[model samples]
Target: MAAGAPRIFVSHLSGIAVFDPAGDQVGRVRDLVVMLRVGQRPPRLLGLVVELATRRRIFLPMTRVTAIQSGQVITTGVLNVRRFEQRPTERLVFGELLDRRVTLTETGEEVSVLDLSVHQLPARREWEIDRVFVRKGRKGSAFRRAKGEALTVEWTAVTGFSLEEQGQGAESLLATFEQLRPADLANVLHHLSPKRRAEVAAALDDDRLADVLEELPEDDQIEILGKLKEERAADVLEAMDPDDAADLLGELPTDDQERLLRLMQPGDAADMRRLMSYEDRTAGGLMTTEPIVLRPDATVADALARVRNADLSPALAAQVYVCRPPDETPTGKYLGTVHFQRLLREPPPSLVSSILDSDLQPLDPEAELPAIAGFFATYDMVAAPVVDEAGSLLGAVTVDDVLDHMLPEDWRETEFHLDEEVATDGS
Candidate 1:
């Protein structure tokens, strides 16, 4: 849902038909899964449990959901068919929350939860249960009921759904550090005991866990991946960057790698296999397969839109690779590059081909670490496209990936106190 979209009551969502981007019905909404915070703060709407045509239920993350209107849910068409599994921190809106009595913070009068109103936070994809619809009455039995008064209140007006302050499970721990960056959270996980680490890892959502896993050491990555069910492990691996996922898969036994690869989407599996075919420190292995690729005929406006994606790393967004037909890497014949700055200066209607920077040679897929580093240094480029001998655009290598290969193996283990005080006057 877009920012400022109408709030939807959970009652209205239950049993609603769900459709993919192509307008084909995929499933029906089964339930909403949310994570309760430590206090009366609103719970984050994780996603929906959807029952497919085959009667198998799957989790549809809100990130993949594009619209909820006219009594139907629309998705991005990338549904994960794996069965929905509720974590320790998750709560089912209809199954568990509704009909339960929670006390109003001011009156101490208990009210039954009739429904919940969820709204997408402005400028963010995250949604939350921001309002509560409740009936002020004595507890009602399954068949008989006492309905005194019905009213709506802010989520904070009630108590009892939030986690206890003294809670010690991974749920509480996750709520405490919910705002930390993945790398910072990975550092926190690194110091935890093995049991605690696994608990925390399992509790995290797939996208989040994938990011944290990328920052964690190899042993931790393998250990945590092993503890998860194989289906879930494959899901997490698919969520990771293609290059990082391939690197992690390379650390596993070949049999184990193939099994997980078989579980992934065919295209993602293909990318992993292609990436793994190269030496670890080579350009092909270090580059991400999902860089922004635009056709020669695309306009400056088109390139800018792709660059503006919130998910793209700064380095990846630094420039766009203009290519022939077949935009996805390994794309059609390599054309040239269009830096973000040049796009801004060009008129929106101007074709990307007109402003191409073709003079700079693209990196070969087999380029070694030292050569790749020298190319970045000489060209002052944050990212450079990688092409095969046949001039097909393979992927783009960013400066960060080059540095990762150049750094000492134990560099991630070294502690740097970014918060340490610095002398102001050369004292």
Candidate 2:
């Protein structure tokens, strides 16, 4: 935490904010780019990936960065709006090289690179990888006795991975994050470059990928979906909730939408088509066709089980609809809904119909956005069923979906800064 510390851990630099020379905030350092050099020499710093408050990322050359500290970075106040695209000669330190294996020059022992530090060299504008932190005896070496302490090595003492992606591919990246929840993985993807994002998306399973796509910003969602092969995109679309899939498809050109729909499961495609037929602002467009459905006589226990589906969001899972025979959604008749709170209060054996909130009227598929919002606010409900004239259930709109539509279209791309204050010498 010294003034413009010359040596620092890469992890500490990962999320630090970047500010302009005027002391006004710009954005945070999403990642550092370096140009890989010939064999045995450490790569030199090339630029920074700056993530703005709007969730959009831009590239800033190292020449534009004036200072670095534990919590903040200083920029020359020049920002390039062009997105970060990797040149063949460059590499990302944390994203591609961190946690990689390297051979120590002193002991000739293998170790995992734990962190690294870059320093401003002779020229005021030039920086180089001068130090490295490696976890010794990563598996079975005698240094394992150090008990989790990492050895700080100068960059010259170890060998670096040569691949642009650090000798790893999409599969390796996916395996590294397989344990993370879809939402967590989605968050990581949002901060990565488009190529890296596409690599990870290509490696995720259809269902897991579907979950993550739903959490991404609309533009990112479309881009990732576009990266998938048509067949696989169709599969992922099928795996996604009808409402999310519909919204994503609706964003594409009509022909592209038709092409993707053609490859989806007939049933899913039909549901998506029906949802898309309604105006994007209508209840039908915001609703998922596959809400938990209960036969009028289904027990409270059954209702609980239906909502327990892992794929359902909290709002979507908060209630179960009661319909006549053939209780699958889009059912015979929309009897009413049984809120989870009602189910828990009643005995496990109580029929869903026994606690149905018949007073909470359903919305018409064509109900406008404001009317739908009003229904949710007035009823204090997280979800409401949509029904047709025949009184048959069409779908259910969750509060989350309504909010997604309500927020400004560009809300996701705005840049923001943390409220914490950072003292700098303005070097």
| RMSD of every prediction | 17.0, 7.6
Q: What is the alpha-carbon RMSD of candidate 2 to the true structure?
A: 7.6
- Please list all clashing residue pairs in model 1, or write none if there are none: none
Candidate 2 displacement at residue 350 in angstroms:
0.9
* Reference-based TM-score of each model: 0.60, 0.69
lDDT of 2 by residue, 1-104 (tens): 22344565566776578888778886777678888788778788888777665555678787877677648988877676655676777777756776566678
The lDDT, on a scale of 0 to 1, for candidate 1 is 0.83
lDDT by candidate, in order shown: 0.83, 0.77
What digit string (tens of lDDT, one per residue) describes model 1 on residues 47-153?
99886655555788999888999999988887777656778889867555665568899999977777789999999989999998888877554234456899999
Most lDDT-accurate candidate: 1
Stretches > 4 Å off in candidate 2: 1-39, 44-91, 96-168, 175-184, 415-427
